[model samples]
Target: MRTAVTAMKIPPSLLSWRSDSWRSDGRTDSFSNEYFKRRNQLKRLLFACLVRWFMTAVLVMGTYLVLWRYSRKAAMISNKKKEFNTLIIALSIALGLNIASSLKHLDLANFEPLQRPKADYILQSENFSCLFQLGYVTRRHWVRVYVLFWVLVNVASQIAVASLGLTYNINSADTIAVTTPGVVAIPDMSNIQTGKVLSSNSQAISALRYTANNYGLVALAYGFGDIDEMPKAGSLFNSDGDLMYCDLNSCYYVFYEATPDNLDYYQSVATNRSISTQATCQSWRVLKGGDGTERTITIDNANKTQLTIPALNGGSQTTFMVDPDRGSGPTWGHVLAFEASATDPWFYNCNVTIGPVTNVQNPLQDVGVNVTSLAASAIALQGYGASTIGVSFNSTRHFQFQSYPAESYYGGPQGGNNTGMGQLMASFAVGVVAITAQVNTNVNATGLLPLKGIELDITSWTYVHIILILTVGLQLLLAVIAAVIASKVTIRDHSCVGLAAALQPLLWKLDNSGSSRTTCEKRIFERLGDGVKVSYIKGRSGLYYIKADE
Candidate 1:
């Protein structure tokens, strides 16, 4: 018997099926292939697919093996985001192509018949409800578990690959050996000229300086690169005794710590505790004649200049030897003495030191060394072409009182008349840190070496390889299984319209008088079984039709 089917009027959405996708080896009734002959053809197709599966496996495995070996060191990349993204994109494209090739297979054994239920799992792999269709067929056809396995593995590998960067250590960043100018003071600093700290147009340093315009004139010069608008480094009178330096986003800190040392001289006065809190303690006082009862006026033996604060009741005694010549020639160098009365516990004599800090755990805490005299240089510039920045501090320039004024010790620097000794010390420190930060900003450094970085954490970062393995591995394996039993695998557009059109051959055979809706079509076919022998033929109007025999 011979049956012919013309094109059906299908909606645009449902007509998307590629009806001609399958190759019809049998012609019309005159050339119809017997059932056993077609079955043999399916068996040969199965063998060919098995060969393809093995080739796919070898291709995927060998490609990844070469990749894994070549990336043993994986030389650190400076632009991590760019390079890593490139790698992921390349893999995604390659995987996509490989997956596309493996998708349209009727993975089957040589003798198995293509059944309605089996085709459901095979052909519907590209459907929107593919997961659901796969689930339904999985009861009798468990090969879909392999598909689900690959899906789950891909999800897991993707998550691991996304977070892989966080696991990397400093080795992931590219590095180069470099010999740079070390920290110096005076000639040591001058010899290693850091790039000039700022452009001539910038008043950032002068503005943040504790000294007025005249005093900071020496430090204001066009030396650092010519960036016009730059971030200001330290605040004016930043008396926290800590400075922050930044380069290339990495940061460092300098903290000034005051620790009490062995007393050079201590004289007990008959003045009461109230004497320690006198107005002279408000600002660093140019000490005049003391109370004259127990206080004696005397010059420092070394420089003859002195800053004195006679303790008032309930306050503290603070005195520092002043260097008159503004030159480094005194026996004592630069030291401050604060002697709280026997009853007062608030203030004590201490020496100053600067500590190196990579992290800032606490801003209030003071942290590193005894300051006999500070004349060292801090390098702000990084790499070649960096301008040499130098800071030279000599004279005792006055500073805005930051803390501990006798008038209101609890208040922050209120009613202070004398200059803070540490304020002067802060001037030196501020210049060091600010200059460094400024020069670093111009050069775009993270602070020290620009290339400082970490290596890949192999334990976690290797997830990229696993992504390839699971994506390619199970895909090939399952593609082979999904290809099982069916004679032909459709490679054209897998649209519902195309599929419905191709069913024209079965149109006249199945029962659809009352329950002929699309939903009942599957049951109708299950009841009838896949026994029809059909062929696709090109018609004269550039269209194709279906022919079936009974």
Candidate 2:
């Protein structure tokens, strides 16, 4: 047995300990300097295993916080997933730095240190699989096992972090409703008479003519099947923003009130916006030339009729109209034409149903007010009181309406180079609220705006935010616990040079035993069969070393 041990070249450092403890070799001065340099092992390990891990966790969680908010516009990466991926990669690298610190952390894995496999300790530091092997190998000891488990926990959190992309993929919401930092336009009737918008030379008249061509009116169908179910959709961009919509139900109308932005203050802050709505809606459809005579079609003023694309060109036209019921103040009237031609009829007489909307704070519910002559004269206004009556709103809501904005009139993506209120509200409705290079020839029309909605009612969203919060939150919790439990004591360096230095006494006593002089360490370890058992020693002045006994 002794001869075989000798042939195996087992170092004296592993076989037995010196009686003096301090070797009588010529390396005392070198050993003393090395031991003194490694004194703050505990502090270093604390920072490595705890401070670093927590910092990484915070960074990861912070990234998720940004992603949860759809309103957060990123200046750097436009794509959501690309931005998240970049952040994950950068923070993960920061997390990886802790691995080096953990190599020496095993020395202080527990308060009362005991003998373990030295080769296993050193091997597990750099190799991932080796760490698991050490974990299983040290399963009998609670502290070491948990320490290993802590590292695994960190790894698990990172995996969870990696799965964030997948989570977004699987759980992304199709549509999101939020009150955003912007504006929606509803007409202010008070300005109409004072502004002389009806005058032939008025800016509104010119804008109206341009609107005829730029946003040509299309006919829509209003199902009489359920007028009682007034459209909950609140936007006019797709359908009329008027109270007169659907089969024929009376309405309690409220609208977002905003003035025409001069394109300078295009993005209106929703929090500061004033809300107003009309009590009822009255729609008028006027047809000219198709049936050989000018005919004014009046549908149920209490309900909206769905329209189809009006027949075009063939010398005929169908127009949708808006008659802002003249209140005590001067509210204007609107004529939206299906075809833009100088000869096409304009209604000075009241026979057509005007797609009218007004501002009312409170409107009596389930009551119908049919104002066919919304803007006839002050004499008519005196007969009924203000065209739009004011009421107190106990509870009002901003409902949703699904509408696509009028397409580029010029017919190309390289649209106008100025954001009209018309297209500005349209862009963000798709996400990425922006008013980019939108332009038009008519300066009056370009400056005027259509109603743009700000996010107020968030009924749904693009991604499942609650799930993401819970998952990332859970990841943070796990990471924090692991960091606390892994308060390691690092005695030796994790680098190959530091590891070699720690085992110097043993290495120095061994010689190449294989016939091949250039044999690798792998061959030598294989010949040794089971690896060496190791124990630690506290020498003079808190110096530490790995030693073994036969």
Candidate 3:
């Protein structure tokens, strides 16, 4: 013990009272000498130990703080989890709103043509698109969420509706009946004349004679059901007011042309032949049976069937129903009707009366008045009578009719655009699952991927949302608490605050060994029996040293 104590010699600078207690302030000070001489050994050792412990505490806290600060940034890089969440929300909103709006537009696309613009009409008529745009723009947010909810809700609703549909069956006249295979034809002929008090055979003969006379030119040449030429009026009559006649059950002679000279010759040559014509024309004479000359059919007049006035070919009219109370109107298209007569009757009477018929066209009045009024009146009307049971609706509803809600002309994705929310959600789920699965196989499993990831199935979306709400919200809450605790413990505790504020920089200046340099110095001087030679150089600030010859 005596030998160990003798071998330990303090450094020359530490031996001096000035160097032990005082620090250099640009130059050596006299106070340094006074302090060293006055201070005791135990006080110096205690101060040294306090400084070492303070520096050690500061370094530990600083490293922990650095790591904590970088953790959020690292999470941003290794896991795009938050980004996917935001993306899913935005995409869901965009898709849901557009889809719902599209359906709403479809419901009313053809109800009022003016409400939906023509393909090029949006640019041409701002008035037309204005109504459509107004409907959707204000409704965008609710519509999007509504659409998504609808998609989910509709799955259940459709199943219920399907079960309901099974309760009743509805079909149109297009259904086939086993009793009838084809159209049944009826025959009538009051057009042929020249008869009174005649027997069945005589009446039949008269009918045969009349038909042969009228249609004989063609029948005599080509037999019954045959035309020698497209028929002409005078083809069957001879100059003598006689006919090229045929009896029932015989083929007849051909008479393409005839004059007075050939009448007898024709009669003799046609002795073995007789032909009959099928005349289908019927006639009805409506004598003025009613009290007044001005007569009306009164066809369900209270129900208001639109009777198109009689006109020559290619003519029409336009009209509208205006609600006096509501200040609104529904414009309409033309109507049509036909009349018939008998003389010169085969096809000429009704044909001449109503000129050539053609198809009618209109945007609003595609369906006739009867159907249009039923659909239109079903909605709320301003002037509906008190007696009316179901004029306008109290709430909006979806109704289907043939000519009413035709295909919509607005708010649809053009040309195969995959802009729906369903697709976006599906894509995010797929991407997340893929990355997470890859990382679970490849990287350390402790990463963020293990904590926040999802599968590609939409059926599981609700559960995923629930999990996210619980997980993220909980994490945010915990992080807030943890940050508060960490800050108080790190920055507010008296010793920790002092260590950080006071001793951190001093330890930072200790070169490679840092604050451990004192241990290294003690081992060299006290245990190794080494002495260091100090060299004084003018204007130098710190001690310079070399190992003394051992």
Candidate 4:
């Protein structure tokens, strides 16, 4: 039982039939022949190639012409007098056009419309109006031009601003250190419960007072530095209404007035308030967050104690000394710290209780007895520079720390207080260093060989490259368009016989036995080609042409 096997090659026609079968059903183009007009296709392809080449040539020539023309015009105008006149006239015309456009779009004001709209909570919500204000700016040519000019002006202005910053002599910032007592031990303050009012009026006063009493507050005197020269000792004074001279301390004249510290000032501020639960007055707690890097100290009016020290002079740097308590091992305490402007020193609100405590053992000695604590003996006080001021005081009441308040209460002339001069010099020095660092140059260090590279090179490089690319691209594009227009003029569509000859292959024939009859009838009705009409009427086959002799 053997099976016979046969192999046969398919004919071309058979293969064509098989290909047709393999064609995707319902997917073949329905009107593929519509684009197969050979004569029309030839004309279009020729036109496209002509247009492309013409455009390329026109672009090249136009760019060269524009640059050359502008350069020649600039060179010919030698006298500043003529140049100025031309420039002014051109600027005036441009300005007038800009003004007219602005006026045409001006929105007139009406009293009713001018009335402020009620605050729309929906619109005010960040979600509804995120970046919506950007839409108000109109995008117009004049506006763009104005913005460009403004940017250029600012670029030039920065030089002057930088120079001013360099010239401004900054004195060291002023910082005050209020003396405090060292905490030997925590005196079993666990018996004192939270929310209990230590004041007689049942009003829960700030526990900071008791804490400061047990554990002294160590306040850092910032912005304090060496002065050019010390002022007369006649400027220094004590709280006892007596002028005291310290041979060890240097004094300096200050421009602002001072206020003597007294107990009456404290009592006047912390008055009794209505009794409330600790929960209700929970706002009194100075909530500290993070590693004290960013802490918030919030106190309500009822729980707040206001003690007005001498008002600081407005816009002036003050100097003060950082004096430590003798025999008080590493005095540590909590104090309200204040930060000055970039040019000023970090100041402290001297805790009235923490400074020169009275009505106690060793009263009026200004001992470091005010703030002692149990957790840590050595506390940090703020010093000059942008460093953190960390200090643990005598009181076990630990509070985290962070940036200073948004505003300062200082209100006198700089250097008015005797202690302000040194502080001013120190603060100024720190501020200068900060400014120098911000400018990316270290003070007293030879900046990099190219100082500008550190400050502005990157931005300058970016803009330079951008300008180069844009200018080159724009020139090329403009030249292209110009060349295209110019080429359309220069490259006349002179009928090229060669192009016409090349199209001969796409010709078609209309002469046939039946078509000849039709052609004769059409030529007769069209009143064309009398010869062709006659030829068609005579039943002769030939090309149809119209002539007078026909």
Candidate 5:
């Protein structure tokens, strides 16, 4: 038992406190070493924390400021007011959450290779499992790509909503009015024919010859012409004579008197040369009797009556005759005659007389009035005196007519009570109140126009929005994980083993004994078995070294 105790006892040289010569070795106090290591770790942790805070502040506040300034600048340049407050708030929240999560993932200890597995080892381990392969590479790039895609989709949706314009229906009334003027009168012809005389007798003789030949009395008058003869007097005859003649149809007696005054008086009223001589003879008051013939007579009195004689040439003659009962009647009676031929019969004479002249004023009148339209089912016009006019506006054409509203004259669609008088009265009332003389109306008119309203079709984008939201969340998560991975120090293969395994060789005396070595190896194998394949291989130095298989 004494021998076993001695073998297990620690040597004095190994323990510095138990050795008098410990000062000769250049080693610090164990407690002080531990204190310094702890202090260094604390400093490192604080530095890491400060860096994270700085990065978070820059990312959050800097991004917000940049985005705010950019939005304002864009609004000014485009001349449009855009609201980004909500978007800014949402972005800030997202960034804050990201920062918080990133900070949460940060571990100061992960920065030390002695404290954790290196990046290569982690990557190797991740290769062994498909689940961890994503974490092997940074996911920040993919998250940024996805965020861009989401932003594009959101912008497209907004544009689509803006493109949907306006729509609606309209209805109304329109009116029009028109006016025009009335009839005209005629002028006189007697004063124009009153100044010529010697030429009158010649005209009378020529007229006598024409009348005698026209009546077929020339042959008979010349054949029996020798009752009495007198001295030469006028151009009507070579000498004064009285001639009597008879024809199968009638008998005529001719006498000529060619005084200048008498010729002048005859010329004033004669229509032609044939009547001039006969007119002069009658005015002398020498001949009297019915003569059973018709002749034109002229009277100068203002109270004279007018008469019309039918002519052989399909025309009539107008002449004035004095009122026989008037006190200022002419002293002479004029008679001129002509018998109708058997081939042309004459009926009772037609008497035409001039009536007293009247004075008149023109009233408003509408002629060729037209109303047209496609929208109106009916159009109507009404005027004073209960006159109404209507048009069936069914045809896209003009409705035209002459209408006298003041005279109670109406045209167009008739019979309906609302159409004629009633409509006219309504129009008149409107005009009176409106201080206008014309009124127009439309019936059953319908109009159309545009209105403001909108509807969004988001059914197809429902899943897309959801996907975008989830993608944003995923991006944040990926960013945090990437931050953590970046902050971590690269780990070595040896660091994967726990402290117990590392201190095993130091705490136990395994190198001198086969059993102890076997025990240490077995312990190592047991602890690392789940993560890696452990094997022993002989090296060139003729010693066995442990190896980890991937």
Candidate 6:
């Protein structure tokens, strides 16, 4: 009937795809989007992990450097290179292990997003079955626990080692021996005369027999005043077998019995015109005595305050004569004597030429006895350089004189006296004695002496070794844990639909099959109906329709 034909129009979106291929194409696109999204998420997670690991590495490295510096300095101070090296090695291994464990993701190539999948997907997908596995979490927790334990143990070990190594006890003993000389002063002895007159010249004279006016006589001489004053000369002994010249100046004159040969030797040095012409005094060796010689006397004219007298019989006897009147004549009255035997030869002496004399009590009693009180002139012998005598003295006792060489007149031969110059003159009045003698002495004495030292009861090596072993064990555990976590975490191209939304599609498919859906599916479909859009193609028709829609 001649009707005009009209062209039918189709939607551009629907015209491009066949109804059967639409579902496949949509699924591929969705899967691709989900895969890219998951990949991007995993990349972000990996970046964060890398950043965290890098910071941890920096912190660990900084801590290690600080510890290394401290250990190096301590090693230098204590000279413990081995211990320092051991600690450094252990720390290095521990740091290495930590770094290695942190890099586990890179080693395993596991860049997984930690997103939770739908319960239905979990139940249906074999790949996502292990999402909630406790193995990974347990391993991570245990690794942390072990690392914490290791750190605590290491600290405790270090403290224990340090405490053990640093503390110690010391037992000590020391010996100190001292010897001092005695002093005797006889003042105001100018009028006393106990010997025969030897000279009438004003020049000072030596007391030796050879220096006396009588060249033919073989006898010791003693006196005060100038040679021109006819000073007396005397023998040391008298008719009653007692000391003949008991008068102060005469009795103290140092005497050495001389043979004819000794006399000739003295004359040779004394008569030298060059020596006699000098304005300043000079020293001359005048006498020596013994079987061959047991004593030697040297007279120093310039230094009249001291004499060099050596006891050839292995004795420490020194004597010095003092001039109290401050006259231009020879030294006359006071005598400072030092006596030390060879068997106990310990001597110390100090001479104080100027300054006020002060009292000195026992200061080193624990080390030795302070025998400074034995001297008659205690003040002069109290300070440094003063000899320490082993003998004790009282201020009330009369001065005791001990002679060497066994003089039959004074007493018998005395042996082994523990007295030095200071002790002998320790009791003297401070200012009364013009010249002071220095005495130095020591003996075989024993006492406790304090000394400083370090004892290593526990070594750093022990602690270092323990830490190293524990660190290695923990590091191994960390490696295993890292592997487990790396294996357990998984990434998959999951649909973007949520659990309830995904259930709607299953309900529709089940309903299309002419089967009643389960109660759980019905509830899921009802709850997610408004939130989901489902697409499908009409059978035997070219039109696409939404099976379910929000």
Q: Each prediction's TM-score against the native?
A: 0.33, 0.39, 0.13, 0.17, 0.18, 0.25
Q: What 10-residue stretch in candidate 3 is worst by lDDT?
A: 345-354
| Best-matching candidate per TM-score | 2
* Candidate 3 C-alpha error for residue 288, in Å: 44
Task: Output the lDDT of residue 303, model 2.
Answer: 51
Superposed Cα deviation of residue 247, candidate 1 (Å): 21
lDDT of 1 by residue, 1-550 (tens): 5477795675543112222233344544321111223344444544555665665556556555434443454343345545554664465455444444445343232112234554444445544256456555545444566556545544553453344334333343232211122211111111112234333323232222222212212222321111222222211113232233322212233322111123232111110000000011222222333322233333323443543333232233333222212422211122333322233222212122333433433321211111112211111111121211231342233211122333321222221223343333333333443343223222111111212223343455366456546655665555445544343322222346656645555564554333345466567765456664444444432234444443
Per-residue error at 284 for model 4, in Å? 9.6
lDDT of 4 by residue, 291-316 (tens): 12222222223545432212232223
Best by lDDT: 1
- Give lDDT for model 6: 0.28
Each candidate's lDDT (Cα)?
Answer: 0.34, 0.32, 0.24, 0.24, 0.25, 0.28
Q: Residue-wise lDDT of candidate 6 within 380-484, one digit each (tens)?
A: 121211121332542212232223332321112223222323222211221112111101121111221112111222235465445445444443444444434
Candidate 2: tens digits of C-alpha lDDT, residues 89-201: 67545544543333223332332333345344534654555555656556457645655665665566455545544443312221222222233443322211212222342
RMSD of 2: 18.2
Instruction: Give the alpha carbon lDDT tens digit for every residue of 336-450 in model 3.
Output: 1112112110000010000111121212112222222221221111121211224454222211101101121111111212222112111211221112111111111110011
Query: Candidate 5: minimum summed lDDT over ten consecutive residues — where?
Result: 268-277
- Cα lDDT over the full model 3: 0.24
Query: Best to worst by lDDT, what's the order?
Result: 1, 2, 6, 5, 4, 3
Candidates 5 and 6, the one with greater TM-score? 6
Q: How large an RMSD does model 5 have?
A: 38.9
Better of 1 and 5 by TM-score: 1
Predict model 4's lDDT versus the native: 0.24
